[model samples]
Target: MPSEAKSWRWRYRFDGKEKMMSLGEYPKVGLKEARDRLAEARKLWSGGIDPLAERKAVVEAKEAEEREQQRRAESSFELIARDWWARWKEGKSRRHADTVMSRLEADVFARYGHRTRHLRTSSVKLNGS
Candidate 1:
């Protein structure tokens, strides 16, 4: 059998419908803090804003930011170049592909592999240009 857990929650009506929102867990959120949270939610409701919707929007924005950071990390120059090589090597001679990859590792990747795909050309300073 699982032990029961205690949590603080607030129940209120919005848009002619009943809704409940979790404030926090017991012990972690004391009585005073729970009441404070309830008051904040009520204040928002009185101001014609749905506290639940506002909280959901904030959570979604944070999630979106996290996903964007992950995307940028996955799109580094070395990763993109390796992905391209996998497709470009098909039907090509092993020696030719190996030579191409060796040159890229020793030259391009050494200098700019850590950069993300969103980098602009002007941001990179060429040796000759």
Candidate 2:
């Protein structure tokens, strides 16, 4: 985002409507930066995409990815377990799924609920190191 300078803002018209987008302040953004931004906007426009919409889409995607990453960090183990169970249970009988879930709760979740490092390993370590 650019700062405001001298009552002027970067303006462009799209679909018969005029829109203004802020580029940084004068001396901060200067002629080259404003030209660069205008060139970029024109590139997007030439590609048949609205610059503002494209920017919004990019920002939204980034925010969504960040939120998902934060959620995974917060409950990665549980998420992994649930995903595993979901895939494993597909086409299985309800009774069998219930029994398997109960056994996992008893034998796995309690011990590994807060300990996730081992969840990714293919075999158990024996050296205790």
Which one wins on lDDT?
1
Q: What tens-digit string does per-residue lDDT give for candidate 1 at 22-118? A: 9999999999999999999889999999999999999999999999888887999999999999999999999999999999999999788888998
Weakest lDDT window of 10 consecutive positions for candidate 2: 120-129
**C-alpha-based local distance difference test score of model 1:** 0.91
- Candidate 2 segments exceeding 4 Å error: 1-8, 78-129
TM-score, candidate 2, is: 0.50
Candidate 1: where are CA atoms >4 Å away?
Answer: 78-114, 122-129
Candidate number with greatest TM-score:
1
For each candidate in the order shown, give its overall lDDT on alpha carbons. Answer: 0.91, 0.73
Model 1: what TM-score? 0.65
